[model samples]
Target: MKTILVIGTYDTKDDELHYICQRIADMGGQVLSMDVSVLGDPSAPTDLSKHQVAEAGGASIRQAIDAGDENAAMQIMARGAAALTAQLYADGKIDGMLALGGTMGTDLALDCAQALPLGVPKYVVSTVSFSPLIPADRLAPDIQMILWAGGLYGLNSVCKSSLSQAAGAVLGAAMAVEAPVSTRPVIGMTSLGSSCLKYMKHLRDPLQERGFEVAVFHATGMGGMAFESLAQQGYFAAVMDFALPELGNLMVGSVVHSGPERLTRAGAAGTPQIVAPGCADLVDYAGWQDIPAAYTDRPFHAHNRLIKSAALSGDERRALVRDIVARLERANAPVHVLMPKGGVEEWDREGGEAHDPQALAAMADEMEKTVKAPLGLTMLDAHINDAAFADAALAVLDGWIADGTVKLG
Candidate 1:
């Protein structure tokens, strides 16, 4: 039977949490109810009591309550909640976790859920589920079941039925799933259609040969964000960031810029990272006609009938180097910036329409000046797609991961 862990301030919402627990039991799942109440007695018989929670948190229940501050109380409760869930997990008593809450209850339950590994089903039924959540308790990483419960104190029959079904849903999902395959550490890579196909094809075979999986992202705005978000989520062991055309798009006011959080995750999450200036030679624009008339005088490349590229100017190159350097500094993981001297893109090589020796040199000089200490910079004589370049990129990542060069933040 699947084990269901239900957490709440049983001193207050005991009836609702217990009702959900009962439905889980009715579905043939074992229930382990935990009470995180600060004051008052628990409304139902619980597997873990608030007093026990306090003790587990290294404080006495009355002592914690006497502190009387909400934030401190929440911290005590979160500590207790994590300890309780961890004990249950160690004793093989938790298969899935669900929490019912408003604000305080959600805060306590989320602490426990966040402590668990990714992919475990953690559901929250809350009043504040629809409310704008502050950054302190953001639930972006964990999956949340938003039940538009507009300020109701007690569950109506409708609430009971919906919550019961939710219990069954989480329970069934927990028990009936086949475990995911234990694949080698996979790296998520970002690239654009113009360069991604050849770039990934060149990188994947060798990386896979070395027992690493390479997941590629098409550098659409969403694709790049999703790639980095997964890194922040701890889904990838390393990142082979090749395409930063999204930066150009942002600078030139195009539609393909990934959000401001792009390169920050690798630093924050401490994932091993290697970034390249691939496809940074130009900003991508839609249709030939859509190319701004102002850009008509600049060097341009027609990658296809639909796509046109504009070579970044000297001033733009300086700004981009600053942007890239700032991103590298924010990276908590060991970072290496690989500059392809021969070319930054497929069309940036000698005889290529967008090739500009002066522009490339300025970019390199800016990066050399901007990146200092522990963070390293590599200048490559070959293009980004070259076998030598890919090999060097992989070597930097492998070396850092093997040597513990990147400190986990």
Candidate 2:
């Protein structure tokens, strides 16, 4: 039977917390409770007591009580709870985790959830499920957050429905979840969809045939976040970072962008990387929102109902070259950069809607000026979608594999 670790401030929400534990038990799933309460006692004992949690965080429960500020004391408890939760998962004592909370509980729950690795099932039943108060970086890439409606006061029927569903979801996830495969060396690649970026089509097969697993991530906001997280963990043997508008989006303050650590992680982890500016010419904006005044006069491409793009100016494209090159320069591993001289994205070709030859020329000129040795730079006389660009990227990968830069299985 799967075991779900239940976490909460058992002092006030004991009734609701116990109800979830009961549902899990009824479903033939075991429950291990951890109470993170600061003052009052839980209705019954917890598998991990408040005292244990406080002590694990490098303080005693008496010290937490003596500190006497709610937020400050809770921060201490959050630290302890996260440490213990990580230890529980590491010790193989918990299969999945479920937490119930309002703002304070949700804050601690996020810390606990992040303590576990990427694949672990982490569900948070909270008052603020998807609130803007919760930053994107605090969340585990795989966390499931459900609104804990009618769950604050007591165990009502509406609250019971949410609790039961969460219990079932966590248990089911634990039983059915498949860990990431590791039969061959994994290649982490980034790309936009085939329409905008076409190099992945030619590259995926040849890399796989070389006994490498090519895992391509879409370079949208959350997709890039996941890619960066995996790369930080040193999850890939090598990375082919082709499509790169997410970096540009982040630089331009677009919500459709990923977090700050996108391009730097693979190299920091010492993984060999063949980087390219596949979609660096455009900045993605949320299509549903009003177009920002700054980009109103620029060329636009409505990729879909959810996302749109605005072409950067010639000067902006030149600035992007410096940013991309600077990021590559900081990588701690083997790094080679590919610059497609003709154009980066599909819409930037001669007759395409967002085409601007001068902007492309400015970008190429800046790359030529800044990209230097120790970090390899290859300038190709082809569009990013052309066979020459793909062939050049594969050749770099083949050369890396032939050498000891990329370790194979």
Candidate 3:
């Protein structure tokens, strides 16, 4: 009953593409083939042919061939393929998508997969499945990718196994996947783990009782990426974006970062945001890698084998706060800053490894100096981990709810 759109260069991978279509049919799933070949024709014809694909991208097949550059030609195809894929999903013709490629194919496949919305199933069987060649920004947040092992040449047992699994995976995902649902207005919140920042535990139940669903995201790299993606899509009614280490990570030249457009997207979409300087003083980096030369002497905490945190100096904190305040200034919706003077993260408080009272004070002073009128700023005499911090945040939300800046469910 499910429909899977199978996309590939049918001119080159005729046998493999057909075999995969047969498997989908054998499993009672309907298949729609899209041929993205530039030079050669498919053995027969596809539901969407190379000429159609080229025209969808606003050119002809001859244009691609005339360009005489593989990369440039494929980019044209990529654009067309993405547009047609989005059109197909919009028409309800596809419940899922399956794509196969080497480097060039994977590149186009990524574009097509990203064309679909967040929840519709997308699977890519690629030679460079998890390689650094594919940047994280180009990938759909929920895309599934499998390595096309031993699939360089003609069909073999290994390649067939991968192809068969990809077919089943896309079909199963389309049949069984449950779309994101909320009966109440959703509050998208962000913060660190319970040990470092504990407001999520205290705030979630109270927000639920107020007839709002609170979705808490860990402020690590990928988690922030997901939060920002959803926020840009207008998913959040209101947001409490408290966990902010990713911003610091990005500014501090750390590779463990979300995209460059992290903090600004929610506000650009006009989502009311309650901002906080939570964990703004720390930059996270991969624990397995050597510490960056700039922060070698600074306080460091190895949270786990996968990640570690490094605190900034007094002057660095000051500059970071100024930059953060500047970002908050550009919000189209109402924005407020809740600064916990005692500490941002748990370790930055008393009796912790990263306790540095002077640095916290320096950051607070800079925030006070930088934040101005029309943008709300509140300095709490508490750590972000304290119950009082949660209470203050709740009070802010209550005020917004009463004023109708945040609509009630």
Candidate 4:
């Protein structure tokens, strides 16, 4: 039978945790309960006690209780829980894991969930699943979450319904997952919506035909963060970074910033990368968000009710190009830059809303002046979504692979 590790502060959430445990067991699974409580004794029986967890975190339970600061004690427990959970996973004692908590519990659970590798079954029942309090960069790529509604301190029909669904989901996922017998070299690619998707569509099948599994990440803020995190973990064999609107958003202090270290990881990890300014002509804001005072007069395009895009001014475009060059300059691996003279995105094409030849020229000039040797720069007459541009990108990547610069499986 598969064993699902149930984690929570059993001292306070005993009743709810107990219900979920019974549900999992009734569904023909075993439960390994871990208590992460820092203050009081656990009301429910635990397979791993708080004292054991605290010790693993480099502190004693006695030290945590006597620390006198709730935040400090919880941090200590979080560190310990993360360590113990990872060790359990490595020991093959865990098939999947589930956790339930409010704000504090969610924080601790996130730490535990991130300890496990990607593709593991990790789920959290939290009061704040996508809330602003949870940093997007800290979220694991495949972790799933259910918002804990109506279940504060005790179990009710409402809470039980959600809990039962969560139990079934995690169990089904764990059972259905088949471990891979052989691995294929993975190529990570990034693209936005319709504006920058043509390159991805064109490149995916060809890369696979050349013996690679292409992983495409939507260039939304969270998607970029997950890509960078996986890259830092040495997950990609090569990277085709086609969208960089998130980096521009960061420079303008927009809420859509992926993270501070957006374009630096593949270079630091020595992964061959093909970089492009796919959407560097625009920055994104929420559909309902008012334009910032500094950019109120710039060109704007509302994609839908939830997203809006703003065209970058010539100066802004220059800054964006410099930022891209600086990151590529630090690459320890082969890095190639591709510039499309026609336009970078659908909206920036001829007779399009974001079209501005002067701005594009400014960006190209800065790239040519700043990008130095050891890093290759190519300027193409084709538009970003044109077949010719796609061919050029594929050629570069294929050459690198043939020359042993990009290792294949």
Per candidate, the number of residue pairs that clash is 2, 0, 0, 0
TM-scores of the candidates are 0.65, 0.93, 0.94, 0.95
Count of clashes in candidate 3 = 0
Better of 1 and 4 by lDDT: 4
Tens-place lDDT per residue, model 1, 328-407, is 78777678888777777776677778878888888877777787877788888887778778888878866865686532
Q: Best by TM-score, which number?
A: 4
- Report the lDDT of model 2 for residue 402: 83
Off by over 4 Å in 3: none
- Clashing pairs for predicted structure model 1, backbone only: 267-331, 267-332
Instruction: Give the Cα-based TM-score of candidate 2 against the true structure.
Output: 0.93
Candidate 2 lDDT, tens digit per residue, 37-76?
Answer: 9999998899999999999888988898888788888898
Candidate 2 positional error at 226, Å: 1.1
Write down the RMSD of candidate 2 (Cα, Å). Answer: 2.0
The lDDT values for all models are 0.75, 0.89, 0.89, 0.87
Candidate 2 regions with alpha-carbon error over 4 angstroms: 62-70
Where is model 2 poorest over a 10-residue stretch in terms of lDDT?
Answer: 132-141
Worst 10 residues of 1 by lDDT: 134-143
